[model samples]
Target: SAVISQKPSRDICQRGTSLTIQCQVDSQVTMMFWYRQQPGQSLTLIATANQGSEATYESGFVIDKFPISRPNLTFSTLTVSNMSPEDSSIYLCSVEIGLHYGYTFGSGTRLTVV
Candidate 1:
């Protein structure tokens, strides 16, 4: 099993500001993923980070808005660039537990832009 920790459980920021979130894992993992849950919405995949490679983002997400970095096997970071009120959402870090167990997510970083 892998344990993941995220910083800034909640924060409020001004428009046009950016916030960087850190994700640390207790165990080395092959893949780490980022997700967003807007108010009253379901979870959506932002990107998938793999060690030694660029992050693969999902549809409707671009690197300029949500840049990701995976420096090693146990750590990664996601930066929410150029924040806006529309960007307000719960950002979460996740990793697959096992072939049968599926993915496990961090508690989430709640961001509110105003």
Candidate 2:
């Protein structure tokens, strides 16, 4: 099983400012997934970060707005740029922890844009 450590559990930022949240997994995961959960909506896959390739983002997300980095197998980072009130959401990282079990998520990073 992999344990994930995510930082900046919550933040309140100015409208134009940006926030970078980091996720560190205990073990190497072939792929790490980033998701956004809005106030009243379901989780949307933001991107998938792999060790040696560019991240693949979802339909509505672009690299310019939601850049992701996976320097290695166990670490990754996601930055929300030019944030606005509408961007407020819970950002989480997930990876399959075991064969029998499913994905396990880190403590989400909750952002509030003002």
Candidate of highest lDDT: 2
- TM-scores for every candidate against the unseen true structure: 0.96, 0.96
Candidate 1 lands at a TM-score of: 0.96
- Report the C-alpha lDDT of model 2 over 1-114, residue by residue, as the tens digit: 679999989999999898999999999899999999998889999999999999998999999999999999999999999999999999999998668879999999999999
Q: Enumerate residue pairs that collide in model 2.
A: none
Lowest-scoring 10 consecutive residues by lDDT in candidate 2?
Answer: 95-104
lDDT of each: 0.93, 0.94
Model 1 lDDT per residue over 1-114, tens place: 677899889999999999999999888889999999999999999999999999999999999999999999999899999999999999999998779878878889999999
The per-residue C-alpha lDDT of model 1 at residue 66 equals: 95
Model 2 scores a TM of: 0.96
* Candidate 2 lDDT score at position 63: 98
Q: Look at candidate 1 and give me any clashing residue pairs.
A: none
